[model samples]
Target: MITSYNFYFCYIEIHEDYVKAVMKEGITVSPEHNDVLLQIVEKHYKNIPFVYITHRINSYAVDPTIYLETAKISNMVGFAVVSEDPKQKIQIKLEKTFFNKEFKQFDTLELALKWKDDMIKKYRD
Candidate 1:
C-alpha cells in the first residue's frame, strides 16, 4: 500500500522490511524548495537501500545539480524516471551526464520497477 503526503506530493510504501517512496508531480528540485522533500525522504527512507522514483520527473525545468545533490544525500540505489516526450531527449542526455552511474531514466514505469527489483536483489540480502 502507498501512503501519500498530499502536502508534499510524495507517496510512501512500507514493505515488510523495506520502504519505497514515489514522488509525484511538481516535485521541486531546487535547493530552497526541497526542504519538505528532504524531510519526508529522510523520515521514511534514510535507511532503505533501494528507492524508486516514478513519473513526471523528466521536466527541463528541474535543476539537475539540486536533484543530484538530494540523491547523493539520500544514498538511494538509484532513481528511474518515466518520460517519452521527444522534447525530453536532450534533457535526458544532460541528466544522464550528471547522474552518470547513480540513475537510470526510462520510458515506462514497468522498466523502472524492474530496475528497482534488480537492485533490491543485488544490494539487499
Candidate 2:
C-alpha cells in the first residue's frame, strides 16, 4: 500500500520500499526539516531497508549539510533525485559529496524507481 503525507515544505508518498518526496517551490530545505523525514522513517520504515527519491517538480534550494544527518539512517539504502533540469544535476553532484551511501540522479521517476528496487535487492543480499 502507498501512503501519502503533505507537509508545509513537501508532499511525500511512501511505498513499500521507497519514499518519494516533492518539495515545494522556492523554499530552502534545511537540516531542521530533516526531523519530519526522520519521524516518517521511524514510524513507517523502521528496521526495513528503503530508498528515498526526491522528485524535483519545482525549483528549491537544499542545504548540503542535510545529507550528513540523512546518512545516519541505517535502514536507508540509497538516495535518488529525479529531475530533468541541468541545474539540478549540478546541484546533485554537490549534494552527493555529503552523503555516505549510494546517491544517484535520474531524469525520470520511473528510472529512479527501478534503481531503488535494485538497491534494496542488493542491500538485502
Model 2 spans > 4 angstroms off: none
Report how far off residue 67 is in candidate 1 (Å).
2.8
Clashes of 1: 0
Candidate 1 Cα errors over 4 Å, as ranges: 8-28, 57-60
Number of clashing pairs per prediction, in order: 0, 0
- On residues 1-125, what C-alpha lDDT tens digit does candidate 2 reach at each position? 47999999999999999999999999999977899999999999999999999999998999999999999999999999999999999999999999999999999999999999899999999
Q: Candidate 2 versus the native: TM-score? A: 0.98
Cα lDDT, all candidates: 0.61, 0.96
TM-score of each: 0.72, 0.98
What tens digits encode model 1's per-residue C-alpha lDDT throughout 1-125? 43555445455555432334455565555676456656766776667675556465423356677665656654466666667776765676776766634576777767777777887777766
Collision count of model 2: 0
Please give the lDDT score at residue 93 for candidate 1.
72
Model 2 residue pairs with clashes: none
lDDT agreement of model 2 with the native: 0.96
